[model samples]
Target: MNKQHAQHQIWRKLGLLSIVMVLLLLAACGSKDNSTTNDESNAQQQEQTTEQTTEQPAAEQPGATVYPLTLKDDSGTEITLDKAPARIVTLAPSETEIAFAIGAGDSVVGVDEYSNYPEQANAIDKVGDTTTNIEKVTALQPDLILASVTMNTQAIEQLRALKLNVYATEPKTYDAVIEKIKNIGVLLDKQQGAADVADRMSQVKADIESKVASADKPSVLVEFSPGWTVGKGEFMDELLTLAGGTNVAQGNGWYEFDSEQIVKSNPQVIVYSSWYEEPNAILEGINARPAWKVIDAVKNNRLVEVPQDPLSRVGPRLAEGLQSLAKAIHPELFQ
Candidate 1:
């Protein structure tokens, strides 16, 4: 062969070999891309499967309460219910509110005079207040008598003496109040309603805490009644703390605070309950006090008048009260 022809043949062979190598590389890259895409698809499928397995169905979840249920009250008294209470009577305002909140309103045969919320409760038979009329309650033929261990001690004893079922509640904290509501739901066969109320309360509390989490806790004084204040070991105190305020009241439970102590604490915000007669007069009286003029709450015009029922009563409306209190304490954050 001629030298030129031989060189041309060698060049042709090299070009063909290069083309084949390029084709093989392209095939390998395509295979790798396809494998990676398949792996990602499989991972997503597995993740979805895991999620499906972890989630429980409504049918599989806890349902209605079994019959003949027995439970203990806050006072540690054991009581058994043969069936859900068809007719119920509440001796305390808190218990009445809980019953109404938990969808047991229709079942409430009677309520104390102070159970004045929900408007419908006012139409119910008045069975008196903390000191309920045992005869009136008996006439209602209540299968369950809801009372407060602290507020309706005498009524509970009197009712139980007449062979009545009295479940008295005495929750000391905010969480305990929620638990009590849930227990009442079980007692009245209104579990779903109770859960809904509890969840709402929890959400309200969480939202309030989150809003005030970064803000500085201000010194606060809560006067639920005239010349009365709540301290540690009470739900009101917990509400104050949760609303991002440091309670100036010292001691545990309810107590009377004098003008001297009020001047000493010098709270930045003062929350007074409007339940007392002549709320405007009460505010005027506070403002007129010569020593209180030097106090920060009075000086800065931070005197907040709150409704008496929701805050003072340990009931479903307490969360609403907390929100109101939070707004009063941290108006800037709320606004």
Candidate 2:
């Protein structure tokens, strides 16, 4: 009875023990796999959350805010922009230039025929001239329109009726120009860039002021090619001040001065700007007149021909204009 029964019993106990050990090992492996899978899932979720968190700031950028902007322009026209403007259409060339400076040039979808600067702006569709072409502008379907109050007021009203935001520029002085830039920056949600530009302008203006403050004041005559003089608080007056010169036209705005006024004022420097490409015709008109000889600026050969495009534009470029005016008024100061 004993030896055979003992051997079978020992073998049966060993086999059962082996089966139990195999089941336990399989359970342990399953548990380990489950833990690894859960860890990987948690790691993936954390990475995704990090990525989303990082992207939120970029997505939170200010763009075309829905707020009101009420301000006056150079022409003393009170204009209101009731939201941050995206998708802009500018009627004035200088206003479009301001848009570019404020980092919203991409938003300008349409412009008037004169809005050419920054070069890339030339690619945008032209709404029309300073007058008419309302249908053309409407076709482009811009959300905002930047213009001058000098343009027909009815046009602004018409655009407004279509629920478009029309912001007008009316800068009376250099400070007002800075304000206009800031307003445009706020309107386009590019306030940061605008502030930078404004700061740069401030530095330049300060530098020019230092130079002008030291210079001898000369009598300045700023004339258009056709002999139209800007009298009194005007763009020419500002330019003359920057050049350390006294504007002969001080306080009368723009006017047609008789030849006698030119003789009587006895300006020390004469700066003429022509809207024409050559401006030779205007110069010819000036030289041909015997009355031009009487003016001190003319007799002294102080006639300077200003490069009309940049010199005439009243945006960020006005600093350069001031430099040009300084040179015209006092070439020795620049040298």
Candidate 3:
């Protein structure tokens, strides 16, 4: 072949080879782009599957958010609830009553042995009294627990150590009792129910106060047991004052009184609580004290008996106790 023709043929072959190489590179780049796109799509799909498997369904969420609910109990311990308590345990009769009164009765899964009010309370599982059955309480798997000073302190501490949420109450006055009731309501999301119950109790108390505001205030002695009487700063003492009667017991809290002090105090009306099954038996025991006959209350037959639960229990029935004591101390005014 001629020299020019040979050079042209070589250049044309080189050009064709370059064109083929370019085409192959383009095909490889297109495959890499498709592979990358497929990889990205697979990663997104796997992430979506993982979320579906791990995340909770909206329907499975609780009706109310229990988390973020935090408050300091009467014992001064701070408590945080993760979810609204579906099961509750009460360690005191008064706490049980307050819980039920605030429309949280259904939530109470267990109560102390002394819980007898509201009739239904009697049917609830009893986990013992101040000496609570921690095992039984634990078995109930209560989300929330109610306690008080009345319960054994040791047991409360043990429950706390078990990581159980315990809210203690030690309301000493009628107002404090109402506040506790409302607080329980708030804890259980029953604020309206608690407010209504508290309002009704206040109205009843106000009525009694108005009726005896101008009445004569008499010196009264409240006998809890045979010789035990409540003193100042107690719910019973405040109830006496509210009912237009002065508590003759001198010291604070509860104390034992002797026949000498009773005679010296000379209470116009002697009041006995129905803690004992037979109130008359309590009166007999009181009368048995030496030199007791000389007391004005004994000689004048001014002894009266009142329901112990209503008077002593720090719960919804405290207003009833106030009225009962008012009538007992001043029958003429009530009549």
Least accurate 10 contiguous residues by lDDT in model 3:
25-34
Q: What lDDT does each candidate get? A: 0.68, 0.58, 0.65
List residue ranges in candidate 3 displaced over 4 A.
Answer: 1-67
1 or 3, greater by TM-score: 1
Judged by TM-score relative to the true structure, which candidate is superior, 1 or 2?
1
List, residue by residue over 211-265, the lDDT tens digit for candidate 3: 8899888889987555656676566678899898988899765555666887899
Local distance difference test, candidate 3: 0.65
> Backbone clashes in each candidate structure, one number apiece?
0, 10, 1
* TM-score versus the correct structure, for each prediction: 0.80, 0.75, 0.78
Model 1 TM-score? Answer: 0.80
Model 2, stretches more than 4 Å misplaced? 1-84
lDDT by residue for model 2 (36-148), tens: 11223322322221112111122233233334545433334345555556688887667778889878998888876666677987898987753547898888777778766
C-alpha lDDT (0 to 100) for residue 170 of candidate 2: 45
Could you tell me how far off, in angstroms, the CA of residue 282 lies in candidate 2 after the best superposition?
A: 2.5
TM-score of 2: 0.75
